[model samples]
Target: MSLENNKAFASVLTAGIILLASGFAATMLYHPQDLEENAFKIEVADSGAEVDAAAPAGPVIEPISALLASADIAAGEKGFKKCSACHSIESGGANKIGPALWGVVDRTRASVDGFSYSDVLNGMNSETWDYEALNEFLAKPKAYAPGTKMGFAGLKKVDQRADLIAYLRQQSDSPAALPE
Candidate 1:
């Protein structure tokens, strides 16, 4: 082969060798490993098949009505920062990925104007955002309403959920009275 041809072939071979070596080096430096357990776990409900009547299902969720009376609204506001990404809590706020949450406490489900709601939430025209309803929904969104478009994994802490709900109540001009 000509000197020029041999030189080009050598350069191509060297580049390929360097690329292969870098790939191996990268794998060694940053290898993936299986997690020991999931960082966050979500509960999914059973299908339409009937469950054993006597057998108690999953963990029993405690009602948060009493907790709301003393819920730390400040802490709840802090916790709700994560939700602000998709929702706007200010009065007359525009909708984003999720609907505007102004006056959401005690508001009817899927009642926000100009926001496209998921079929799951839209189907609940008769439902209201009552304290107990919010508690159960925030505890486990998917379990509360299956096929919901909401992606939140649901807060595991009852206190945190209560606090958030309390803060939400304050956002409205006329907050609904706490449950009896």
Candidate 2:
């Protein structure tokens, strides 16, 4: 090949290599995994089929009441470090990114003054945060309250949630009684 043809071939080869490498790197950086279930479904009006709404797919969370009796408050407090960035567990503590959780265990949901709660949570203001409620919420925040602004993905472990609840229960001046 002539010197000019050689140079041009080299440039084309380098460009082709770069293109292939970038495409491969992009795929590696963003691995698109197949979802276990459909994220959302739109029902066809004329399908004429009964569509039973199914719960989101995940392990069935066992109630944490039995776990709370023997749950380690110290470990729970340790777990709170992860939550401290968003919540304040101290009595009379000001709200951070999330509402102050000082007395959140049995407190009314979305009742914290001055802290803006999501519409979904505001709708649930009448409800109280009992042990079971906290358990479920801790396990999966989004699943419990869809469209909630709380960005925490949620603690996945049952024991971790139970312990965290135990610690939160102590943050109150008058702690709510543990579930039997």
> Which of the numbered candidates is closest to the native, going by highest TM-score?
1
Model 2, C-alpha of 66: deviation from truth (Å) = 0.5
Candidate 2 C-alpha error for residue 180, in Å:
1.7
lDDT of 1 at 175: 93
Q: What is the C-alpha lDDT of each candidate?
A: 0.90, 0.89
Candidate 2, residues 9-48, lDDT tens digits: the string is 9999999999999999999899888999889874322342
Cα lDDT tens digits, model 1, 1-180, are 899999999999999999999999999899799999998885556885988989886667789999999999999999999899999999899999988988998899999989888888899968899888989989988878888888898999999999999999999989989876
Worst 10 residues of 2 by lDDT: 42-51
Error of 2 at 76 (Å): 0.5
| Candidate 1 segments whose C-alpha is farther than 4 A from its true place | 17-56
RMSD of every candidate to native, in Å, equals: 3.5, 7.4
TM match of model 1 to true structure? 0.78
